[model samples]
Structures are given as C-alpha cells and as structure tokens.
Target: MAKDKLRKVGEVAPEFHLYEADGAKVSLSDLLGENRYVLLYFTSTEEKSRCDRSGCPLKENLEKLIELDVTPVLIDVDPVEEHKRFKHDHNIKFLMLSDPAMETIKGYGVYEKVNIHGIEKEKIVSTAFLINPEGRIVHVWEPKKIEDSIDDIINAVKKLKGM
Candidate 1:
C-alpha cells in the first residue's frame, strides 16, 4: 500500500467545520482561536478491535491533555448518532466530530483506499496532528502501532508546550 501524503510541520493546517456528536458545529479556526494548540485525532469507531486498541488509551488520558492546554478532538467518518453512542459507550470526554462525507478526512490528507475483509473501502488512516494557535502544524504522527501513537502524541504535546 502506498502511503498518503500528509501535512508536515510548519505547514498551515487546513481549515474545516465539522459537526460534533451533539450536532454542534466546530470549526478549526474556532478551536485555534481558543486554544494554544489543537490535537486532531482522525479515527474510526466502526472497527471495534481497532477502536478499542487505539481510542481507549486516548480517552483515558484526557486530563493530561487538558492540563497541557491542548484541545483534543476526535474525527470519524461515522454519522453523528454513531459518534454519540461511541462516546457514551466509551465515556469519552472530548469532542468527537462526525465527517460522514469524509471531506475533512480527505482535506487533511488522511483518507486512504484499503481492502478490508475482501472489500475495498475508503477509510481515514489513524493520524494525529498538533496545530498551533497560529494554524501551523507543529507535529504529525502516522503511527505504525496504535499503542505507540498515544505516547507520541503526549510527547509531541509536551515538546510543543516547551517551545
């Protein structure tokens, strides 16, 4: 499989407006206006095994992220209701935005065409981006392992704060 081109550090992050689980609209510019940094996590809730392995740890560490003044946002290709239920089931505290059209996913350059269970589908590759208040991407992590991504994100947040 070919790797998708991703936004790199120092590039101005793409702006997007997506709906949260509660149907409230969230704009990237709005987040940047309020927070010093935004941690955008692109993931899926459809695959339970993968979601549990990757999403759970991030859910558990919400407080740490908050303390660092980084707003963590979860983006999924699922519908709003599905995202709502997923958050409820997992007790996730952060905002989980739904991008059913996958426009934001594609705009972020995380969308990939992959074969799953003998079926070809376009899915958002699990990725994390740290965008500074100036709307510049400060860190990008395309993890080979979900477990490692959590630590990478935390370290990236710390490093960004230190800078």
Candidate 2:
C-alpha cells in the first residue's frame, strides 16, 4: 500500500478530536486556540519492541518541553482503558489519547498496515510533529529509531521557538 503523504512544516496540521485516557475529548484546534504549542506523537503499545523504547525519548525531554511551554500529547490506536494502563505503567504525565478507530491516526498520515506477531493490523508509525501556537506544523521527525528521536525533536523545538 502506498504511504500517505505527511503534512510538512509550515502547513496547517490536520485537525482532529480524540479521547484522552480519562475519556475526555481533545481537539487540535482547541489546543491551538489556547496558543499552546503541541508535540504530537503517533504511537502504539502493542508491539513490544517499539513500545519498549517508544516513550523514553519523550520522557527524557519532558522537562525541557515543559520549560518551553509545549504540550506533549501521545496518540495511540488503543483502547482508553489500555491507554490509562500504559500511562500508569510508564509514569506518563502528559495527555495520552486513545484512537481506537485509527481515524485520527490515518488523518495524520501515520497509519501503516503491517504484520505484527504474524497478524495483519493497521498500526501507527513512530512519528512526531511539532505544531506552533498558530496551528502550523513547525517541525516533523520521522525517526528511524524511536529511542533516538528526542535530541532531534528537542533541537527542532528549540530552533522553531528561537530559543
């Protein structure tokens, strides 16, 4: 299958509304409406290999992100209950969104159909995007290694904010 084209920097991010782990709805526009920069991550907790090292980069840079006043949001194609459990297990303090239907995931061009554990399923690719307060995508990281993406992400945010 052909991969969906990713939204590039300077383009308006595709708007989406998904539920957080607590079942609270969150919208991109609402987040931008408050002038908050968003570091959006498309991820999944099912793959042990990817999941094992997935959140470390974000977790390592959480304090720096907070210092920059950026809101980190993790979007996964998993159930709300699962997301809640994952967040708890990982000590994730930021918002963890549930995209069970993969609507928001595909909308962002991060959904990939792959074979996992010998079963075919649509899973989210490991990708991150930084949206500025004006709702434009300021940075994008299509990391080859999920665990090694933090430095690039942090540097992009710093460059975008002129810090």
Candidate 3:
C-alpha cells in the first residue's frame, strides 16, 4: 500500500486479530478498556537485532508506559514462533504480535513488497500509531517522525488525557 493511504491521526484505527508470541489470539478491542491506550509499533526486517533501536526504546520505557495505562504492541510479518524467540532473546515482556499473513500490516497500509537477495518478500513500512480507548488514531509516527517516539508517544498520551 502507498504511504498516503495509511490510516492517519483522527481516523479510526483498523481492527485486527493476531497471535501473540505465546500463540494466543488477540484482537484490537481486547486491548481497549476504560483509561487504556495502545501504542502500536510496526517492525521491519531492516533492524539487525531484536534489541536494536526499533525495539529497545519502548522496552526501556515500558514501566512508565504501563503506569500511564498504555500497552505497547510491536507488530511484524514474522511468525508467532519468531516473535516467541524474539521475546526470549531480548527479554521482551510486552505484546509482540505476528502478522505472517500480512492482514494487519496491509490493513494498516504498512506492507510493501521488496526483494532481498533477489527474492521477493513482504516488508513492513516502519510506523507507529497511538490509539485512544475509543480506537481512534490520536497520534502517528511515520518513518521520519520517530526519532524519539517513545517520549513523543508518552507526551501525546499525557497531553490527551490531561496528565
């Protein structure tokens, strides 16, 4: 999908039912509740390691995020088993969802087909979305906007919730 077609701030975030690292099915609504928020970060194969900048930023601030009632979810095209190994390797306790079928990735307009080593593969366009309890996209961090997204997300949630 094209970048322009992505779900933007103020729109209702797309619904998804994906498997977590433990192979448990989880839906978008399952994570929503009174005073709860979701910070979704899409993963890319470009990151050399699970503990790279892409994953650690949020992991580092996980406690503060939970204190604010926000759930940090990292979605990737990898399989559930891969997500499981990632959690084990990196000590990730947050939700790491698998989207091997690319359902959620395409729905969010973050899927792009790229050839690596002359073999075509589905890749994710790095993106982040902060969804409010009502499932509305309140904040978005596209590739270029994510220099310090963990901080930006926290501040956005704080500003929105009057914290």
Candidate 4:
C-alpha cells in the first residue's frame, strides 16, 4: 500500500498501535499523557544491529534528549521477535516498538521502497519526529544517514518547551 504523505508541523501527530519490546501495545495517545513531547525514530526490523548503527542517533544525543525531557521512542519496521532481541541485546531503556504489518510505518509516511543490494526493498526513511503535548508534529529530521546528530531534535524540543 502507498504510504501517507509526509505530515507537516502543527498537524496532529499520526496515531499508531504497535507492540513494544515486552509485547505491550503502545500508541501515540498513551505517550502524550506521559510526557510533554515524544521523540520517535523509524527503523528496519530485519537489520537489528544495523538499526542501532544506522537508524538511531540517541547514542550521540541521549543526554540532550534527556535534558529536554522528551520521551524517546524507537519504531522498528521489522518483526516483533527481532525487536525483542534487539532491545535485550542493546539494553534499551527507552520505548521500542515493532510494526511487522507496516501499518504504523505507513501511517507516519516513513515506509518507502528503495534499492538495496541491487534489489528493491521496503524500508523506512531514516527519519525522526518530535510531537508536542498537543500532539502536533513540532520537528522532523530526515538525514542522509540514519545516524544524524540529535542536537537538532534536542534543540527543537527545547524550543517547544520554551514556548
């Protein structure tokens, strides 16, 4: 199925339902009630180790994210089992969710078919989104590499908080 168009800032963040690492269901509404903002990264499930190396920048900007009190969420577009192991192996403390059906990925408009090893493969765009207390997308990060500097995400959250 074709993914939805990229949403703009001020639009209500797209709602999603996916399995977290522990098999609990997590949705946008659940997060909105817990924190002032949510920081999300969409990644591929087939590539577990690579997801950390490519789809994430939290390692580089974790402190900044914490400073802004933004709840970090990782969305793995792979299988739930893969995500479970990935979370365990990495000792992930933040929210980690799996969306094997790609419904959530498409809802966020991050899934795309791209050339991989000379073959077309479905993958998520290396992107992140920050949603505010009101559920509006306040920031977006689309990097050439999955591991972009998270300073931007932190700054956006800080700015939003100051407003």
Candidate 5:
C-alpha cells in the first residue's frame, strides 16, 4: 500500500453510497448522525479468521460505542450475498456494507494489490477509521495489527468523547 495514497487524519472522508449486507442502501452522510462519529472497518474476505478475531471486540463493545453516539460500520468488496453470509457467520451486530466495485475501498486508499497463494489481486487490507460528525477523519487505527487497532479505536473513541 502506498502511504501517500492513504487517507490521513483530519482529511474529509471520501463519500459513497453502498448497500448493507441485507441489501439496504446506506451512505456516508447517513451514518454521520447528529453529534456522532463513524467507525469504519474495512475487512478482507480472504482473511476471514482475521476478520472475525478483529471484529469481535467491536461486537462485544457495540453498546458502549452506541452510548457514545458512534456508529460502527464495516466495508468490504465482497458481494451482498457474501457480506450477508459473513455477517451472519460472525454474528456482527454493526452495519456490514458491500462494495464489490471497490469504489469506496479505493477512495479511502485501503485497496491494495495483494498476493494470495501466488496470485496477485486487489483487495482491502483490513483497516479502521474514526470519523467525526463533520466528515473528517479524526484518527486512523492502523498503526498496528487488526487486534491492536480495535483496542485503539475504542480507547480513541472514549478519549475523543471526553474531549
């Protein structure tokens, strides 16, 4: 992944209109609710185990995020059906959005060319971002692995709410 291409803190998040795993339409504007923040997690389908382990913390602490007025969302290039299956399989309580076109994935600079079993392909490199209601990226929880990022996200949220 090109560091220069990645969206940074304070930058306005790129907008997109995507569908949830259940096929419901959604948009960045819709999630940026009044006085709230948006927590976005871009997942990798090829690394489902990683996805599950990374997502559990979010699922576990979902109520805390809600109480803090932060809406957590997951984005992946998987199809609506795949997303539906993954969501169901993982018991994800947050909105899992589909992005088969990779529009938003590339827009957010998370899309990368990766090698899988000797085949090179494009996909999102599991990422998380915390965005303020104003549409700006307040923080990127990618300084470490997915596990640490999730913790950082929650701690960052709590810290932001206190500010």
Candidate 6:
C-alpha cells in the first residue's frame, strides 16, 4: 500500500499496456499528447457491491464527461470472465481494461489489501486520475469512496482544463 503511493501531480505518468475487456491493448502513451484530457478509474470485480457502488457514479456521469471531451478509461482488476459479464451487465461503452495480475493496479497504487464487512480482506480501493495532455497528472482521487459524486471528477476536469 504505502509502497505504491500514486504518482504525484505534475509528474509524468508512468506508461503501460493492459488488455481491455474487448481484448484490445491500451497504453498510457495512447492518451498522452492526444490533446484531450484522460480520466482513469480503477475498479474491482464489478459484481461486488462495493465495486458496483464505486463504478455506478462514473457510468451515470459519462454523458457529462463526454460533453467535456474527457476520455474515461475503466480498469478492471477482476478476471477476464468476470470483466466480460460486468461489462455486458453495465453496458459500459467507455474503455474497459483488464488487469488480472493486478500489475497495472499496483503500478497505479490503487491496489490495496483491505477488509470488507470485517470478513475478508482484498483490494477494495477505487481511484480516479485526471491526466493532462502533457502526460502529467493534473488531479487525483485516491481510494475514492462510493459516497463521492461525479461532480468531484467533473469539477476537477473543468479546473484542470482551465490550467
């Protein structure tokens, strides 16, 4: 956990390639220098209530983000089969990448071992990052709680765009 503190704002984001739910490879460089803001949300199994609650807000706010010209990327740390079902169930049209080994998840510092319901411990953190066109992190929401609203992300994007 502490070993993987997220890359700080103003630092060039680390680049890596991960397979999307649709089987396409997506790399950080793909978004860099694209002249568009990139919004990345690292998610869980999506079947879990925590994952659902964490992801629902982003889905609900997709239209507004699209309106703002922000490209939303969803990273699923669950298995491929689960990710497929989750994608179909949620009808998520945005980029959904799969990181089964959690290599990318740990790389981004969103992977953590936490106990949910006081029963089992697992990676339960939900995080989002707003990266500017220059590849530097402009804003970040590490371990974003389900109670947080999409407005938080939208406002941050709006603010970053003005910079």
Clashes per candidate (backbone, < 3 Å):
0, 0, 0, 1, 0, 0
In Å, residue 15's CA in model 6 sits off its true spot by 0.7
lDDT of 3 by residue, 98-145 (tens): 888888888888877788999988777788999999999998887533
Best of the two (2, 4) by lDDT: 2
lDDT tens digits, residues 88-127, model 6? 8867677777787777777777766767778755473677
Quote the positional error of residue 99 for candidate 5 in Å.
0.9
| Model 3 misplaced stretches (Cα beyond 4 Å) | 48-55, 115-121, 144-147
lDDT of 5 by residue, 1-163 (tens): 6467789998999998999988899999998977899998887766545655555666777898898899998788778898788778888789988888888988898877888999998877777889999999999865434556766777788898784
Among these predictions, the greatest TM-score belongs to 3
> TM-score of each candidate?
0.86, 0.84, 0.89, 0.82, 0.87, 0.80
Candidate 4 displacement at residue 35 in angstroms: 5.5
Q: Count steric clashes of candidate 3.
A: 0
Model 1: how far is 112 from its true place, Å?
Answer: 1.5
Residue ranges of candidate 5 with Cα displaced over 4 Å? 50-55, 115-119, 143-145
- Residues 1-163 of candidate 2 have per-residue lDDT tens digits of 2255667788999999898888899998877745468989887665423555555666667899888778888888778888788778877788888888888777778866788799998767778899999898988877655556777777777776677
In model 3, residue pairs whose N, Cα or C atoms come closer than 3 Å (at least 3 residues apart or on different chains), thus clashing, are none
Q: What stretches of model 4 exceed 4 Å from their correct place? A: 1-4, 45-48, 51-56, 115-121
Order of candidate numbers by TM-score, starting with the best: 3, 5, 1, 2, 4, 6
Sliding window of 10 residues with minimal summed lDDT for model 1:
46-55
TM-score of 1: 0.86
Best by lDDT: 3
User: Relative to the true structure, how large is the alpha-carbon lDDT of every model?
Assistant: 0.79, 0.77, 0.83, 0.73, 0.81, 0.71
For residues 47-113, write the lDDT of model 1, one tens digit per residue.
4336555556666788888888888998877888987887787777898898889888888888778
